[model samples]
Target: MVVIAVFKSSRPEGKSAMKWFGAAQQRGTVMALTALQVVICTVWLTTASPTPYKNSQYITSKIVYECAIGSVAGFSMLLGYIGLLAAVSFLLAFLARNLPDNFNEAKF
Candidate 1:
């Protein structure tokens, strides 16, 4: 609506201004995904540390199993998050392909 309102007078400058603003604003496909993934994974990692079920007080087979299983579960969860993040990043980058060519373009 604001785009149309800005160009209500039908000036090419308004059109150009809108174009430049939109292009600049829409160019963050990878950055946004990466930032989101990092933040989520950081939170996940912080919350998941210490392995809730791990115990080294006893060296029995049951204790060993518990530690191994807990470690594996934590690692698996991290891997799942990584895979999901990768897929999301790929999809977002694909969607943003037509946003703007000025992304990472030469500054000089």
Candidate 2:
């Protein structure tokens, strides 16, 4: 969703703006990037720790040590990516504020 929003916000006005990258290309790019994001998260979470157990005690490892550290790191990285995308989107939108709205409803 953020990827799509960034692309839409950065799109310039005029017929020649995105002559080579039409709607199809935009959709493809978004889909590809979304898939890549999913893969990255999946890989990070799945392979985060060498083993789920911290010590020989199964109860302690499973109950108290349930991937606390790895999950935090993974989520922090995810949050960083989201924050970066948001910053880019905000910058693009601010720069394009003077341009005509792409959606007619936006003028209302």
Candidate 3:
């Protein structure tokens, strides 16, 4: 909404640059997150195993196994990714903390 509103109005000094910067930032963040998620999911799914069930029974043998999460490496990867995201978010927040609430894009 902010970007749309800014673009809809008459041109103003720095408005074009700020809006473009914000849009680029948003796109980059989304693409990075999406790529990370894809890599994580691919890694996790590739490492997954079929669900285990008790028995030597015929019924158990008939059960079809599906992908299930169970791997130390996958968990570690997820944790590392989460930590990285947290660290980045924290850094951005800290940097923006001093900015005023209104028109705070300057710091960003």
Candidate 4:
């Protein structure tokens, strides 16, 4: 009876751990993709305009446009990252709740 109880508890713990692992993997993928996107955007911006600004008004307008686009893209990426972090935190909490009582007692 004691063995059966322990086994039952471990099953839920294992499932919870798997869920957290999946969440972490998902976050990692998103992070990688976001980084790739930023890199691509940077490359595209650099390659798009090869000519130097000739007039003060043109330079100011160009700077404002580039800054606006960069800010928007950066904000969107940051929001996605924050969302991923929140999901990971929630998953971790769920996993902690289902973890075995002795989980912290074991050494790595």
Candidate 5:
């Protein structure tokens, strides 16, 4: 009888721990994705122009072209970051829904 009671009590605790662990993992993933997005954006913006040039006389023209390309790349990276954030939010919601009732009984 004592063993049965102990098992029943521990089950709820275990479920609670699992829920918290899932939440933490999801949050960490989101942070990592955000960091990666920033790094990608920085790299795209700082990379030199890929176009071959004849001489240094066209340095100004090259700068303008590279700036335009960088702008487009930055915008694309921004969109990707937003999409990743939305995906992470959806995953968190799904995890919350699937968590046991005992875990949801109290507000975190």
Candidate 6:
């Protein structure tokens, strides 16, 4: 997402802006980077020593006995966070492209 934000800032000279970020190799590169990030996070999570909090018998409220709820909630939160980042970055790119660079300059 940060890569897309930085890539969108420059104006294209001879080619379309899509070509700048959407190259055939770029898709693979982005996927690889994302996977690498996830793997690193997973490694950290797996290697970390758990604290003495025995409360983890219930990741969520003790009222819910189904463990699936906790996993589902976590998955949803992750997806929502990723979606929000993409949406906000795209919105910023849109505003950057359309808004006037300088408001002080007079047309009249």
Task: Return the top candidate by lDDT.
Answer: 3
**lDDT (Cα, 0-100) at 17 in candidate 1:** 55
Q: Which lDDT tens digits does candidate 4 get at residues 1-108?
A: 222334445665644444434556768877986787677556646645233434546565554322334345555655676677779767766655654566557677
TM-score to true structure, per model: 0.32, 0.55, 0.51, 0.34, 0.41, 0.33
Question: Ranking under lDDT, best-scoring first?
Answer: 3, 2, 5, 1, 4, 6
List the candidate 1 regions with Cα displacement exceeding 4 Å.
1-70, 100-108
Off by over 4 Å in 6: 1-23, 49-52, 55-92, 95-108
Candidate 1 per-residue lDDT, tens place, 10-102, comes to 565455555434544555645775676677556656666544365656865555434333345656666787898778668766665554354
**Model 4 pairs in collision:** none
Give the CA lDDT, 0 to 100, for residue 56 in model 1: 52
- In candidate 5, the residue pairs with backbone N, CA or C atoms under 3 Å apart (3 or more residues apart, or in different chains) clash, namely none
Q: Considering TM-score, where higher is better, how would the candidates rank from best to worst?
A: 2, 3, 5, 4, 6, 1
lDDT of 3 by residue, 24-57 (tens): 7878877989798788968876777335644445
Q: Write the per-residue lDDT of candidate 5 for residues 50-96, one digit (tens) a residue.
A: 34434545674554323234356666777787887789667756655
Residue pairs with backbone overlap in model 1: none
RMSD per model, one decimal: 9.7, 6.7, 9.4, 9.4, 10.9, 10.3
lDDT values of the candidates? 0.56, 0.63, 0.65, 0.55, 0.58, 0.54
Comparing 2 and 5 on TM-score, the stronger one: 2
Q: Lowest lDDT 10-mer window, candidate 1?
A: 1-10
| Candidate with more favorable, higher TM-score: 3 or 4 | 3
How big is the positional error of residue 69 in model 3, measured in Å on the Cα after superposition?
5.2
Clashes of each: 0, 0, 0, 0, 0, 0
- What is the C-alpha lDDT profile of model 2 across 33-87, one tens digit per residue? 6786787688777877334544546564454544445666777777787787789
Clashing pairs in 6: none
Clashes of 1: 0
Candidate 5 structure, TM-score to reference:
0.41
Worst window of 10 by summed lDDT in candidate 4: 62-71
Model 2 worst lDDT window (10 residues): 1-10
Give the higher-lDDT candidate: 2 or 6: 2
What is the clash tally of candidate 6? 0
